[model samples]
Structure formats: structure tokens, C-alpha cells
Target: MISAGQASAWPKFAHILGHDEWIDMPEFQRVEDRVKNRVLLDPMIAEETSKFEKNVLLERLAEAKIAAAPVMTVADVANDPHFRDERSMYTEVTHPQLGPVRITNQAVKMSETNPYVRGCAPLLGEHNDEVYQSLGFTPEEISAWREKGVI
Candidate 1:
């Protein structure tokens, strides 16, 4: 496949990615095949089997002018300083059953009105009563609906 133009490289990649073109893009397939076969595939796999450091892989990719990052699992963020630090992309909220739990912080950063987590995810049926009441249901009616398994 032909190489993309040099200007605003990331935006083009983002545009293609946003359009979900990676699966169908011939360029992506070509690059994947090359990386998996011709280039440093065997050495990279060997390095992974032994040392297997994400940072090392990232550095190698950076050297090759490839922008990439290791796929991080949910547990990975808990131990990572970038996620758990004070200025992290994570925020803590109190869960009724689980106590304090960390979740994604507001993605949109605003200087004047910073966003925050109000509370952790609710437990099953936790908001049923409140929701029913808000919809003009009386406690008796809610209890009747609950008895009928409608909620």
C-alpha cells in the first residue's frame, strides 16, 4: 500500500480509526504482515518471552516511528501511578457494599468547573424505590409493584 501524506499524521490515523477502517484498510494489513514476518518479529517475540517489558517495546516502536502502547487491563491501572496518583485519570467514590472504588475521572477538563464522581455504581434495585417515587408512585404502590415483581 502507498504511504500516507506527512502532514497531520495523527489526525488521519484518528480519522481512519474513528471510521473503523482498520479491519478493511489494506495499509494496516500490509504493515501488520510486515511487522509479524519480515522485520523484527522473531526477535520481538523472543524478547517478550524472556524480558517482556512494555516500556522496552514502546521505546522500540517509537524508534521505528510507530505510535503504540501496550493494551492495559483494568487491574493494570490500579497499580499504575498514572492512574492512581492525585492528578490521575481515576477518581474514587464510595460504593454501598464495596466501600471506596476507583472509576474513570471526567474526560473533559474544564478550569472553572472541574467534574467529579458523585458516588460509585449502585447495587441491584438500589434506585428502584427512588425512581418509582419520582415517577409519582406512592410507597404503597411501589411495594405493590415490588410484590408483583414488576420492578
Candidate 2:
């Protein structure tokens, strides 16, 4: 989310970010050019982020008033009160093979219909007969294919 407007602030926080090369990087004329520079930027940012503990880096960013958020893991998201309790952004379901699994809920709410994950994803080829039948294939043909190992 860096922008041309943040150009001034970059130099101030460059020491905290562990890189002075940001000031030397070329000005980007287009989105593609900025994206192309990720080869140089990504490693630098990753290196800098690794030097500090997560909370320490976050505190530094907060002190600098940087608009940044931690990239949370699934367990972290599940435990966060805002996402789990307030927003109800996740739900748990029983996976046939994996047992209980926590899955994300629909972000968008609809007035007329309630969208939700009814079950875990189907196993491979679980709906083969139903799919082929809908496509005008008969039970006999589908069963024959299964018998002949064509499916």
C-alpha cells in the first residue's frame, strides 16, 4: 500500500526499516514498474521484519504511525476477539477424514438468503454420478464406466 505520498516518510523510517536504499530506488511511473521492483524490495523487507520480534516491530510501526497490520496465522485469527467473537468470521465443521476443522465464514451477508459452508469439500469423484447424470448420461452408463475403471 505504499504510495507516492509516503515518499517523505520513507526516509524518516528507513533506519528503523533497516534499509537506506528506498530513497535510491527509481520513481515508478506505473503499477507494473512498482511490481517489477519487488525482486529488490521483497527480500529487503523480509530481512528487516525478521530482525525484530513481531510485537517490537509492530510497536515501532505504530510509533511511526505507519498503516500496517500483522499477517496473522489461522490460529491467531481464530483466537482474535474481533474476528472470532465480534464479527463471527469463522465457523467450525466436522471434516469426514480430518475431524473437527475451523473454516472461514462468508464475509458478505445477504438479507434474503443465508450463505454458509454446509460441509467440508467433497472427496475426489464423490459426485461423479450426479454430475454425469445432469449432463444426460444414464445410471447404466455411469455404473458401466465405474465397472470398467473409466471414471
Per-model tally of clashing residue pairs: 0, 0
Candidate 2: residue 38 lDDT (0-100): 66
The number of the candidate with the highest TM-score is 2
- Please write out the lDDT profile of model 2 over residues 1-151, one tens digit for every residue: 3222254456545656766666666733234544677676667667877888888877777777776678888889889999888777888899888999988888777779978878888989888889999999999999899899898
TM-score of each: 0.53, 0.61
> Which residue window of length 10 is worst by lDDT in model 1?
1-10
Per-residue accuracy of model 1 over 1-151 as CA lDDT, tens digit each: 1122233332343243243343244443454443455344344334432453567655654554555666788789667786667556787788777788778877666889987777777788788889988999899998887799887
Q: Which structure among the candidates has the greatest lDDT? A: 2
- Consecutive 10-residue window with the lowest summed lDDT within model 2: 1-10
RMSD of each: 9.8, 5.1
Model 1: residue 40 alpha-carbon error in angstroms = 14
lDDT of 2 at 104: 89
lDDT of each: 0.58, 0.73
Q: How many clashing pairs does model 2 include? A: 0
